[model samples]
Target: MHDHARGLSSGAHRRPLAVSLALTAAVFAVQVAGAILTGSLALLADAAHMMTDAAALVVALFASTVAARPADERRTYGYQRAEVLGALVNGVVLIVLCVWIAVEAVGRLSAEAEAEIAGGWMLAVAAAGLVANLVAAWLLRHAQKQSMNVRGAYLEVLGDLLGSVAVIVASAVILLTGWTRADAIASLAIAVFIVPRAIGLLREVFSVLAESAPRGTAVADIRAHILGAPGVRDVHDVHVWQLTRGAPVFTAHVVVDREVLDGGGAAALLTNLQECLADHFDVAHSTFQFEAVGHEDRHNAHR
Candidate 1:
């Protein structure tokens, strides 16, 4: 009744993700050392962010690997949802990191005596971190479009890149103006910028977990197209949802003219229906139950 079409595997993204992970890991160590020596809150916050980015990349890489496994009887859809779960975890972690950064920034701002930051040391380390983040971001840029898991990692690295820039600017301000609070202010700005993106990613993850139709996809529009198929009288109980990004599934009960079934045109009608979905909606996996008009009336249990 339905075509079996596997979701696109995440294997293609693994190499770039691995490279980015290495780059982030190396930058994290350097930034941590710099933060300790400079006593710069902004540098410390960026280091923490980089550490989390490395972890997120690891999770994304593992999830993508698991998601490439073939479907079996026990797990008919294979492990495509693993990518979404990975993305969900990354999104939550990002929000938590932001909260920590915000709280620390506030505490620093309220203190009677500000921490003495070595702006020259902070700026040197921050510039190095910025260059590393830029390379990682470029590596994952194209891959992010194909998988939510990769997108989550890409966003984290991009945030880290921005954080590095903020640290550099803060350090420059402190060096030139002797304003110690610039470090705290920069940390606050980085936290503020990351929270919204984390929220947006979480919203997308929840929508998938809820079995909602993919974004920009309208159920009403799908129903209209189904009704347009030759021999189809009406469609009911139509449903659409996604297993992951770019992997949509559809199902419906289609009422057709009795003559079409009796005259042995059912096969052609089914093909037309399936092809209509494939060509117009880009949905390759669909199921349809064909019944002669009024068959639902006899059952009396249709939704």
Candidate 2:
């Protein structure tokens, strides 16, 4: 028996991502203006990060729409993997954006002296950005857990939120103490926050693209669980993996006792294996290939 349930629906992420894109676009404009007016590296870095956020949100929205499509003859898995592709793109963007900020910030720090910036204006714009980022992050908090695409979007927003905080702090230091280098320092700090998040997202996205087992699942543990099923003598060719966030596919070949196969116990055994995977491993879609000892060997040996 094979239970083939579809992956989770990503319709829930559309609204939150739309709201985030609108707010992030607004912030990006404001931050760009602030960066230009004040010549603040911290503001510029935040602006750049927000630009990536806008792009990420757009990708996330597209992925959500396509992922909701039904399976077709040409593409039996539907469009669910679109979310992973979106996540991978977002992660790569984050990495590139962060590295760009780091290099620019380093140049500014190594200069003979920091350029004069309009500290007061920087402070006001950063304050506004901080508020907008907070709202965007909150909106996507719940959806992030349900979809990898949403989670990537949330990480972008969250990184920007931190960047905004750094900008505000740097702007205030420059305003009160006339320490202009604080701008570059804050830019570096923002890069620090962005790198780790980008790396984590990339690892997960790559894992999915590679069709590797999810980090949370252990193949050995699954094999053991299947072997423990009644009337199952051995298990082999066991494979467990996911296409995306919630669509797990498990396939295994089980070698059962000859007595069980001859006594019409095959149906009962199939039910038990399916139920085991569902109850213990949260694996909803599974295929069990049953065999009676030497029967499988001879059946395939001739082929």
Candidate 3:
């Protein structure tokens, strides 16, 4: 059932990402031409924004493919981390793009330059971008609910949609008030929206890569649960980490009653403990070291 669900999600995500990439590429080209023809900062900013959308879709497609690869000896955890890496890359790229846009906007603001604003073309291109991005956003919304990687891509498209709106409003203001500064202001607004979101995503991806404990799964609670099991005398060396976005793994040293080890009873005790952990804590993977009562000193010395 899980495999079937995963296959469906993979298929669903790929189609939208491909379509988004193609549309973003086309929009980027047109926006670039518009920017050059009218020397409009707002149009150029939107073009840059579309460029990042194209790159993000490409990353999403590649990462999704890599993440589907089965586990092997070389990568026992499977390729799930590929998606996190891709998200990190996308976030970094967005931050860099934001910086570039901010720099250009600042330069234009300093010069107080007036662009040959083509209000009609700017409005039309932005409207097209808004519609296309909305469609792309809707297509990925369902898939995003199931996967962090897909959610990252969805956020990127949503950001682009907002950029499109900003460009549309800026173009309107420029046409009405002849305030070329509106174009620079719109670019700055786009940068404001993009930078913090990228930073937040980068932090999340880095946490996963650092093998931080899974969210909402505290070490102290896990320790208490393990020690509360029957026949468990003490627990130490407890470690927990996320194996993927949702899967978690745990390992610990458990001291068991000496009698449980005699008469071949230790295996049954371990089995019961494993079941308890899984049922109570949602730990999918666990490694327990069974130790007899008198062996604590010897085990400690060996370690």
For all candidates in order, the CA lDDT equals 0.90, 0.87, 0.77
Instruction: Give the winner by TM-score.
Output: 1
lDDT of 3 by residue, 1-303 (tens): 011111212333678778878888888888888888777787788888888888888888898888877779999767777778878878888888898999998988898446567777887888888888888898887777655576677778888899999999998987788887888899999899988888877877777888888778888887787788778888777777764555567777788888777767877777776776677777766777777886764444312
Better of 2 and 3 by lDDT: 2
Model 1 C-alpha lDDT per residue in residues 35-122, reported as the tens digit of each score: 9999998999999999999999999999999999888999988899999999999999999999999999999999999899999999
Residue 196 accuracy (lDDT) in model 1: 93
**Alpha carbon lDDT of residue 258, candidate 3?**
80
Ranked by TM-score from best down, the candidates are 1, 2, 3
Q: Lowest summed-lDDT stretch of 10 residues in model 1?
A: 294-303
User: Clashes in candidate 1: how many?
Assistant: 0
Look at candidate 1 and give me any clashing residue pairs.
none
* Candidate 2: stretches off by over 4 Å: 5-9, 258-264, 297-303
Top lDDT: which candidate number?
1
Model 2: per-residue Cα lDDT over 129-150, one tens digit each: 9999999999999989878888
Segments in model 3 whose C-alpha atoms lie over 4 Å from true places: 1-12, 145-148, 258-284, 296-303
